[model samples]
Target: MHRRASPGSQDHFDLFPYIAILMSLLGALLTATLGMASLSLGPGVAETWDMAARDGTASKAPVLVEWDGSALTVHEGAQRRRVPWLDDQAAAAGGMRPRSAAMQRLLAEFGQRSATGYVLFAVRPSGFATLPRLTDDFRAAHIDIGYEPVGQERGVQLLSAGEHP
Candidate 1:
């Protein structure tokens, strides 16, 4: 009988095929992971809202305001002003709370632009508790408004018709 090679004597374990298979699998996995990653990044980082009316009709641009639970930050073009809220006892004393000077200014501005613009509220979750009161105040002042809730940690980007990124 032909002498067989002694076990573990001069027998080279060829790892090339196994290494090639592993590399191929790794490459495929990496490609799949990258493809999935790209699909997950929808739009930009911030949430965007169209500046147009909800009905998708041509309408006036609104004055943007951010409402957290306790205060309002009115945005007029590039300028911003914070309007403070009344204390709980003061706000709950009567059926309606009194408006601050800043709040009145916003109302007056919206009032004047009622035909061309409306107040757009970017409300945070915290603001939901007192949102009814805020809306009531706007109604009392006869200011037209549209509101949309925003995520607490997300920034908002308002895109106008001619301006979209």
Candidate 2:
């Protein structure tokens, strides 16, 4: 003779399997919730860049300028100096003429070496019309030309690279 499970015992036996399945589902839900929470608060791209630069692998350079910011500071680097002539002043000094042969030779040497990136020019508003032709000549010789127009009030007008007219 064999003994069978009582009704109460059978109910308990069936409940154990359902309880195990519920516990597994709850664990999965908890894991997904924690993952999403962690993802919502993380560092961004700029922070990473700051950290990398601070660690000392890369360096940055300062921007170029004609004059140093402080009045006391004098810039002594290589630069182009302009000589302008007004109508009466130019007439008094005599009409415009070609650059001296020695100066032309020096310019040719400078152009060949490519030591300078640009030749800064200062011209009057009335001389603006001649700039396009000057730019063309520089372009043909593989030299970049830049200019700043000085106004009556001594304002600066920057001419962009490759800009004409």
Candidate 3:
């Protein structure tokens, strides 16, 4: 025959299970409070470099270029150079395009050489026109593309492909 515990003994045994349940509830409550606090206290997210604009104007950012020079050099506090094809086009056609294959190749080489932040391309309006395709191509090759306008002209829109003004 089973014998029931005395009242004092039963009370003592019940205290442990009550304490365990209390502790579990407290732990769960603490975890949920911490999670909510974190959600409310985190800093705002930063915008992508390509989406950055300043003072109602598109700012010029640094870009890496591969020139004919022997050693890597940082010009104007950042490395930038004119490719051979760009030079040839400037000489022959009196104008150069920044979105050409040569420029892309230079950008690729620069990206491979540096461990710095994203590469910025100082492009003209014409160059900006080709940016969407270039960005796509770069992404396909696993490269990130960021761009900025170079000249002082205002009211120019640098839209990616399929972007509406």
Worst 10 residues of 3 by lDDT: 65-74
TM-score of each: 0.64, 0.31, 0.31
- What is the C-alpha lDDT profile of model 1 across 33-56, one tens digit per residue? 999988886545567777765577
lDDT of each: 0.79, 0.43, 0.48
User: Tens-digit lDDT track for model 3 on 59-104?
Assistant: 3333432122221112333234444333344547767543455655
lDDT of 2: 0.43
Instruction: Give the top-scoring candidate (TM-score).
Output: 1
Q: How far is candidate 2 from the true structure (C-alpha RMSD, Å)?
A: 18.4
The parts of candidate 1 lying over 4 Å away from their true place are 1-44, 53-57, 87-97
Error of 3 at 102 (Å): 4.1
- Best-fitting candidate, scored by lDDT: 1
Residue-wise C-alpha lDDT for candidate 2, range 55-162, written one tens digit per residue? 454333111122211111111233433322123344557886444444345346436744434444444455566656554644666755555554322333233333
| C-alpha lDDT of residue 12 in model 2 | 35
